[model samples]
Target chain A: MLVLKPMMQKTSAKYFFLMPGVLWILAFTLFPLVYSLYLSFTDFRLGKEPQFVGTKNYVEILGLDGEGGDDKALETATFSLFLTLGSTSMTLIMGTLIAWVFNHDLPMLRQMRAIITMPLFAAPIALGFLGVVIFNETNGPLNNILQGLGFERIQWIIDPWGARFAVLITDTWQWTPFVFIVVLAAMQSIPEDLYESARLDTRSNWILFRRITFPLIAPALGTVALLRLVETIKILDIPISLTGGGPGAATQTYSYYVYQIGLRGSFQLGDASALSYLVVIIAIIISSIYFWRVRARFD
Target chain B: MDAASSLSSSIQTTHSKPGYLPGTSRIGRYLLIGLAFFFTFLAISPFLFALTTSFKTQTDSIDGTVIPFIQYQPTLINWEQEFGLGGTETFKSLRNSALIALGSTLIATILGTLAGYGLGRFKYGIGNRNLVSWFMSQRFLPPIASVIPFVLLFRDLKLIDTLPGMVIINATFTLPFAVLIMRDFFADFPQELIEAALVDGAGHFQTFRDIALPLATPALVASVIICFSFAWNEYLFASVLATKEWKPYPMLVAGSDSVRGIMFGFVTTRMLIAVTVPVFLSLLVQRYIVRGLTFGAVKG
Candidate 1:
């Protein structure tokens, strides 16, 4: 009896320690998640009684069962995909190149690296605001520089393609620093002997980098790419702040689209809820692929 | 004689390796240095431009000049107008943002620390790996998915437009990150100190407060800064949940576009104010941030 008493007490004590956090997660996270799932099945909106629709919302969104799905959802998914690919690749490439440069001995390297990463620290919304100032048609610096160089001012914000480019630029500017810092840390960890031994064989910096540095940093780069994929698809703030998904929904991302449908436009909670579930499914698929790839590497 | 000469050569090579410069021409080195400087300048140019423009008058900000200080006198009209005595809306929003951020950060840190300790130290039938992974997977759920339910739930509870509402929601999202970070930190904590404290008959809470909490200060600091910045920078929930009474600073900055043809000076000033604390905090704990950001996937 006494032996069992201590074990029970220990178990209870652990639960006691875990109670607050678990309860917080339960009430705020799990409950809301379950509630959202329920809401997705019902035609619910603000100030309206929810009716059980039985897969109608999902069907409409997916275009399954011979019904035309929501075009907005498709558009949002396409935009998210494009932005994810564009920004992630750009950030990865630019960041790795810059990290490679910084890996060399340079004066004021620490200060310069810090300055380069400052953009990552700024809020996405703030970056969006800065995007506005930087991409301004006439008074902005980019246009001013163009004019100074005898070039015509491009309509950066008003035109559709220009607005999309502006959003991509802002996203790239904010996230490249993240990749830079991560890759730089990974690069710094490689033993100097590896580089020296490779250097003894070849005077070509390109060959040395390709053989020694690239292979060493590939794992870190993969991790960053996976993380970036998840984050970029769910991006909301930059699009909201910079272009407001403007020039007629040219830059509307997945989250922004969900926000618009769920909260802003007509308050279609059922459709929005279903839309969010679709997003969750896409996210899960991506994450599972990442996990599979990572596990394969380890094996 | 052959053995001694080889050993001496090996030592000399090792010594020279530390001071060895990679083979690059002087011009190439100079070019690389220039490129680094150029990129650095490019990264910070937005901030510098914003800072200079924040000091410009309405007319001066719109003038066709690239340089603010060179073209016209710098003025404090925007700052004075927004942050000075008359800017009640701006001040209120700032205060609300601070309250929500600090409140949520404190809650997330304490809860996460306790949960992390429990998950790290105890064994359970469900398994700690399962629990920890469950907590982390919550982060992967698109926030908009949960946000829809949160909007409805808050509306029913009359939590919309309330400071506590914002705090609760922020802590909810930030909790997963906090738990993941704190869990990793606790898992890495030296076992001997904890063992000694327990062997001396210290209770679990006492051991946590006296032994574990003190040692986990770096992680705690990282958690607090991350939580605060996230809660502060969050806009979606803040926009929906809080209205005129409890609007956050981000909402104020976002809503500024409505005030007549993109007021550059006003917008820039608000943006600078919004970003200053997070940027400063990030710079201070630059090393620890990667762990918090990556959820311990990539150690700093």
Candidate 2:
């Protein structure tokens, strides 16, 4: 009975320490999430009661302009899906390359690395807008320099492909540092004894990488790529601030579309909320795969 | 945009191996070096032009040619104007930035430190990892997706255009990062010492306040720097939140960004003010930051 009493007391005290966080998340994170789902089915404006109109609101949005809502959902879904894939692949590839490049031993590499990663700190809007400043048609340095070098200036931020490339380039430059940091950390954590053992057999670096480093660091890379995937998809600041969904909606990503509908003009609260849920579901599916892989790796 | 410069050197170390493959020959090395220079220039050129333009006479910025590093006459007026040393909106933005940065840092640091200590040291074995993972997920979740919902939420709460609103969101976003970092630092501590303190009649809070907090000073500083930089450069929430009187500095930088169109003098001058907070903080805590970031990433 004494043991039981003390054990109960200890357990109660432990729960005390944890309650704040659990409550904070439940009220803020979980509550909002549930509310978002509930509100998705209704025709609720910001100030409205979030009327329970069943799946009608969802159907209406999915069938905007009498075009059958499923088709709209399918169409936007394709574009977002493609957008997600493009950005994620770019972030992963460029990030890994940046990590590799920065891993070198040059006298200037240290300082150079700081500069290379500086773009990550610059506001996304700043970087994207800077893209226009440098890549714009008039007096931007890239154009001026190209023209001076006897080459023609490419429309870097004006054309659809050009704007897409601009976004790809900017996102890759900013986020690659993130991957570089995580991968390098994982690379460093691999036990040196394994590499030393490989070297006794005169194993080449590539062989060492394939057999030892890749597997060892694979977990961190997976986590990083997953994190980047989620971040890249909903990213809006750069697209909004830089492109503003302009040039005939060519560069408008999903989040920007959400903002345009939700906040910029008339409030399509139901449609916007539904769109966000769709976003969450897509993110969950993509990240769930990575999540399972991560668990498997740990297991 | 929360890239910590302290991290740049660590990755470079792993890539500097002397022994290489058959392909790492003279041509390859040169090619790699050339690419490095190419990117290095590509990265810094905008800033260089911005700097030069800031010094150019406002007229020269747009009209002048960017020669080989020495085309324009230099002046300090733009810097003065930017830092509010010239007494313009630059002063207001600079002041606004520092106030928000300091305020947000103070709040986030205090809350995160307490939360970190709680989550780190006194695990009751009930909801630790689940809570931890939940916190970690917030870091990756796109702020954009959350922003619309939060805008509705914040407006309802009357938090829009207010310092507290921005601070709340900033702290909320930075919490997972802080907890993650502080937990790593706490996990590195000797479990035996904590146990010993418990044996000596130190209550949970007492043991943490006396022992863990003091020992975790390095991690605390790193957490503060990270939180501060995050709050400083945060744009979306601030742009949405700060309506008129309560504008944070980054919003001003975003605004100033468009005003200069190849006009070097004004743009670089404004950028200097925007860039100083991060660069200054990074250089100040370079040593602790590298250790902190590496520890947080690689350890539990």
Candidate 3:
């Protein structure tokens, strides 16, 4: 009885500690999640009872109804894909380059690293506002510098492609440092002894990097790439502030489109909820692949 | 040669293995440094331009003024308008931001620490790995997925546009991150101390409150800084949930435009105000920022 009592106390004590967090998640996160899923099936609107429509929202969104229902979702999904691919590629390439540069034992490189990473911490929406100033077509410094360098000025904010480019630049600038920091850490973690042993066989630094550094850091790069891919798909704030989904919906990302449908302009809560689930599902699939692939690496 | 000298020489060779580029000359090193500095400038150029814009007249900013006193005259009009004693709106948002951020951070850190400690130390029949994954999956769930439910739920509870409402949502958003970090921290904690305390008759909570919590300061600090910064920088929920009374600084920054198509000078100041906390906190938590960001996948 005494031994059982102590075991019971220990077991209950663990639950006691976990109780608050579990309950909080139940009420705030899990409940709302299920509720939103419920809302997705209904024609939910503010001040109107959510009438269950039975897969109508999903069908219209998926165009299973055959009338090209919600073609806008397709358009926005395409834009989201473009932005995701563009931003992820640019961020990965630039981040790897910068991290490689900063990995060296150079003067003030640490300080340079610190300075470069500042953008990662800034709010994306705030960066979007800053992007407006930076990408200002007429008098923006970017175009000013281009013209000064004898290149034709690019219409950064007004044109569709230009606005898309601006969003890519802003998201890349903000997230590149994330890759930089993570990759830099990965690079630094490589034991010098590996290089020491490799140096016996090769004097070519390129070969050394290819043979020794690249393979070791490939996992880190892969992880950063996956993280960036997931994040860029949900790009909303930058488009909201930088382009306002302007230039005829050129910059309208999937999330921004979902926001418009759910919250703004007639408040189509059901459709928005349905759209949100699609994104959630996509994100889950991406991360699940990532986790499954990397599960062997983790304990 | 002595073994220590050989070891030191090997270390020196590793240290001197020139940068990514194959360069041994002093000129090459300096050139690499310069290139690095240029990239650094490119990274921070947005903030730099914004800082200059914050100090410039509206006309000066739109004129693409790059250098202060060279291309255009700078002024404090923007700052005076947004942050001077008369800027009640900005002040209210700042206050609301601090209160909401701090309130949410407090809740997330405390609750997360307790749960994280349990998850870290105890083995459960359900599996800690599964529980931790469940916690972390919440972090990746699209905010849009929950915003509707939150709006409807908060409306019924009279929580929309309230400080507590913002705090609750922000805390919920940041809780998963907090758990991931603190769980990793406690998992790596020294088991001897915990075992000793248990042998000495300290209850689980007692050992946690005294031994684990105090020793877990660095992780706690990292979690707190991360949670606060995330809560502070939040905008989507702020824009939707907070109409006027609980408007956060990000909304103020985002909404800083007039009929003149995005008042560049005013918006710059608002952005600077919005980013200062995060920029400073990032520096303070630089060591743990990577870990916190990657949800403890990286032990950095």
Q: Stretches of candidate 2 above 4 Å error?
A: A1-13, A46-49, A64-66, A70-83, A108-110, A148-151, A190-216, A287-299, B1-42, B62-69, B80-88, B122-127, B257-265, B283-300
In terms of docking quality, how is candidate 2 classified? acceptable
By TM-score: ranked, best first:
3, 1, 2
| Residue A61, model 2, lDDT | 60
Model 3 DockQ vs. reference:
0.55
Model 2 lDDT at residue B230: 73
lDDT of each: 0.82, 0.63, 0.83
Write model 3 residue lDDT over B1-300, tens digit each, in one string.
Answer: 134233323322223332233344678678778888989999888888889889888767777657888887888998898878878988999999999999999999988999888888887677776677677778777788899889999999999999999999999999988888888888888989998998899988899888999878777877998899889988889989997999988888877764356788888888898998887676666667677787776544
DockQ winner: 3
**What DockQ do you compute for every candidate structure?**
0.48, 0.34, 0.55
Candidate 3 deviant stretches above 4 angstroms: A293-299, B1-27, B69-72
Clashing pairs in 3: none
TM-score per candidate, chains pooled: 0.92, 0.84, 0.94
> Which structure is stronger by DockQ: 2 or 3?
3
| Candidate number achieving the greatest TM-score relative to the actual structure | 3
Better of 2 and 3 by lDDT: 3
- Deviation in Å, model 1, residue B200 alpha carbon: 1.5
lDDT of 1 by residue, A259-290 (tens): 99889969999889988988888777877656
